[model samples]
Target: MGTSASKLAILDIVLNGLMRRYKERVPDVGIILDAMVSDGIVKSTSDIENDHIAFRTMGVPQLGVKSFEKIFLHFGYEKRDHYFFEGKKLDAWWYSPPRATDPRIFVSELRVGDLSEESQHIIHSYTNEVTVDGIATDPVDYLDLDNGEAVDAFLHQPLWRTPTTADYQSLLQESEYAAWVIYNRYYLNHFTISVHNLPEGYNTVASFNDFLEKHGIKLNTSGGKIKVSPDGGLLQSSTVAEMLDAEFANGEKLRISGSYVEFAERKVLPEFASLPAGEIKRKHRRDGFEAGNADKIFESTYTTQTGR
Candidate 1:
């Protein structure tokens, strides 16, 4: 899709944040993508723990995936179950890729042989499109492998750019790129910060042309991909930078960064932090909840630092 690079940039940012927060507890990369496609956002920690409580007491969580199969069949947008693991169906959320919300993301379905002469000519027009390591190769063979699940070679190896439009005549083309969205978590102790209000250096730009022009970089922007500069190229990222570069004529940048202790002091240690706690206790009493296995204990310990 035309916006594929932009979306990838966003995913990179969210993935980085998730890794930093949960570390080992953070779900796999695949799970993050699947969740993004269906819900457009990942659940908060409190939300996940709440669902876990629901499973133990009420046998259901508000919206969390119950089993792995539910994740695949229900959330992954898969029509049928394709794989399973050790009698327990694997969660599709961990396997499926995220889809772009922007309509410009869908591309035309081109058949192997039925491609028009114009299409074939267009495919050959590009210098590096039909090559394996820049050497000419049979396009038919590439298409054949592409039809199968040999996407790693076809998509990554290089091929003619595909138009991400339902009809070729439209002005608004779809993006073929994958994307996922993440919300600022309440647990992160920050309110939902808008794109505006970000500091200068922590921002990223989304539109390729805007980023290039603003930064005084030169590149041909006719098709989707832009040629990289000899220098380190545009530092594409999903953080506040993109928001700063958005099509907002009157918008300001957003900034919300602080230490873990600062976040905890503001949000988790506040009186309202107990909202989840209250709900948990209430559910336990109503359902006669029995703590399962007793491996992990839900305890809160707070320590304050005082400067001398």
Candidate 2:
């Protein structure tokens, strides 16, 4: 635990577990990987670099970013910039991975208080279950973060009772994110592919988007097919969260949004442009995330993006 290397190894196991479950839950991940192979982008899925993975959490007592972030922080990830999605009534932060090769982490929390009284009621009615379950304080507080398996299991575990269909729709009318966590609590929201290092044609967002469309993958077109930072150093695109056949309370079935796949192209810094590609590294690229770019990327799960 004292050595970063030891913790990094454990972190790897946790990350693999997250990706495994995410891919199984979101078939688009498998579809995208297969397309990458067929198009000769990479020999296999392992040849792809994961740019980052994201999670969505509820902002309530004993939860949200502060509680959820403890797992990664214990390993080696460093909390980075703060981002607020005003329109979406959410707050988020990006974490720098323990190692340069590791994927960054983007975590967003629903501002439950920002919601209307009824919406807050719907959210608390479910989150309160976590508290009632005897996790009176932060659930992560009881977790041994060094145990990779335990942490992995916790991430995939449901934090609250399944919401009734009516409650889900009610939250959906206010915050799409709230409706999502009510059912998909602590699930890996999405994992990103580092597209900048891919082959020439498939390395850029535009080219990657073209390759994706050819393979019948749906892109989140909220901010258009491509979202670029004003500095033009970061580019991103993601698949719309595919609707999953979810069984709600009382055996009620409905198709709701699940996770998705994201592609990111982090351009080399102005100073590193002269360096050969082989010599360039993560430090030589746009390091963190962009608020504007991430704002649109968030809609990958929103009905506005997924319904199409």
Cα TM-score of candidate 1: 0.18
Worst 10 residues of 1 by lDDT: 293-302
Whole-model lDDT, model 2 = 0.89
Q: How far out, in Å, is residue 244 in model 1?
A: 17
Task: Identify the candidate with maximal TM-score.
Answer: 2
RMSD of 2: 1.5
Write one digit per residue (lDDT tens) for candidate 2, span 1-308.
24377798899889999988998899888888988898788998898999999999999987999999999989878899999999999999999887777899999999999999999988888777776456557888889888899999999888778789999999899888899999899999999999988999998999999999988999998878899999999999999998999999999998999999899999999987899889988889998889898889889989988777
Model 1 global lDDT (CA atoms, 0 to 1): 0.22
The clash count of every prediction, one per candidate, is 21, 0
Over 4 Å off, model 1: 1-109, 127-133, 137-308
**Candidate 1 C-alpha lDDT tens digits along 272-308:** 3456543533222211111211100110000111110
Task: Report lDDT (CA) for all predictions.
Answer: 0.22, 0.89
